[model samples]
Target: MPKIARINGPRAAFLRRFLPLLLDFDKGDKPTGQVTNEKRKEFYDCTTRALVLCFGYENTLGNDSPGDLWDTTYDEIPAANKMPKLPEPESIERDTVIKALTPVVHTWYKNRRTEANSPAGRAVLTQRQVERTVQAFAPLAPPPKALDVYQREFKQDYIDAFAALWAKKLEAAGTDEDALKVLKRQKGGKERAFAAMRWDQESDLKKKEVVQRCKDVYADVVKRHKSLWGSPHDALPNSRMWSAISFHRRSA
Candidate 1:
């Protein structure tokens, strides 16, 4: 019979801590006696499954031995010693589903916007026309529950993607800086042109004056574009002249 080698220090400590949980060993008693063939097989199977679950199949590198899963070449256990606990399988599945669906939702939004702004679409830009256009492309949208979860989880990623698209549209229309300001008003950033105008720095009277000025500008733009802005199908009315504004406003 092959003699079981004595394991000491960190490897012994690790087995003491984790083996019980992995094998459902009795916690009150320390494992003892010469290791039997049956016990060895149980340990190998349990450890192999644990390693595969924690680091994934790729980490195994085609090795069936659980001991081969860790790189002994390193003085330490690579970064695995500091790695966070594995998330529950259900959480992993939920995250995977959300990641897979986000791009599809984004693509659907882009295509719907494109079709709605087409010349033919613009010719019949009524509420009914817009509803019909959206309904025709309804299949493009992800299921509402999935979309809600994705939007909640990846809000910043969605915003950045849309902002990049909006920036490209502005560039294509040859909009200048002054025209871009109207649309920039709705966007959030620390580096905006009016960022220096903080409420705390201004007197109450000055703040009121500034607010009034913004309202006046917004009113003028709406008045000028009233005819074109009649339906959601229309792009931001005079968007070229208004410049850098996004057509889709996500609700807060």
Candidate 2:
């Protein structure tokens, strides 16, 4: 059976919002990214780790509990058996919450682009930074613009979307029924449990993992930017700054 990879909660939340935006390249092990290959791996690993941690896996069990996942330090190097998986929302209702927040993800990336290219020494945000910002919007009341629906309504709608999409993907992939059983897990309480588990888990260990993930992702971000825009300009302004200005100018 094909196993789902695991990730930390914040990264999982970010994926719930922006996964639809990623083009299904159907090529490499990792999703395609504008960043460097190493950065892409960092993105994939960090996001998967976030999902796994958030989804209440035994590996991430709370410190107070006998499971005590905190005892095991977070390591970027995967053990032969360790696989980072995102705990997918199981039902239409839960999936709705995931889908409803998609816009927040888009807005985050757009905002990051603006910041990275800012004329001044604005914060050169990395993908990790952007994911953190988007994750902050979870449980937020549905904004009154394009997504002008009640929170309940949005969650339901998101669930429906996720169900439909999962069915299609599973069918296309020719996956086994048992392999997809994980998708059937009840979502509402499970999602909350996953979050609480992280809270009860050791704070120090969690902090260390988060920082390491961020650093790895940051290195990738730098590689990606350099690859895309060529080396930063020798003079005061960098290529990213110039690119940002041009992007805004074109949009304006």
lDDT (C-alpha, whole model) for all candidates: 0.37, 0.38
lDDT for 225 in candidate 2 is 38
lDDT of 1: 0.37
lDDT of 1 by residue, 107-159 (tens): 43334335445776454245434443343333332222322222222233244
Local accuracy of candidate 2 as per-residue lDDT tens digits, 1-252 = 112323324433334443322322224465344544455344344434433333333322121122112112233323313432233533233234333333433344435434545664144334444544343333432212212111111233244444455566567647667655554444334433443444345367654554455455446545443444443364212344445665688999
In angstroms, how far off is 67's CA in candidate 1?
Answer: 47
**CA shift of 213, model 2, Å:** 1.8
In model 2, where do residues sit more than 4 Å from their true spots? 1-80, 85-189, 231-252
Q: Which candidate is the best by TM-score?
A: 2
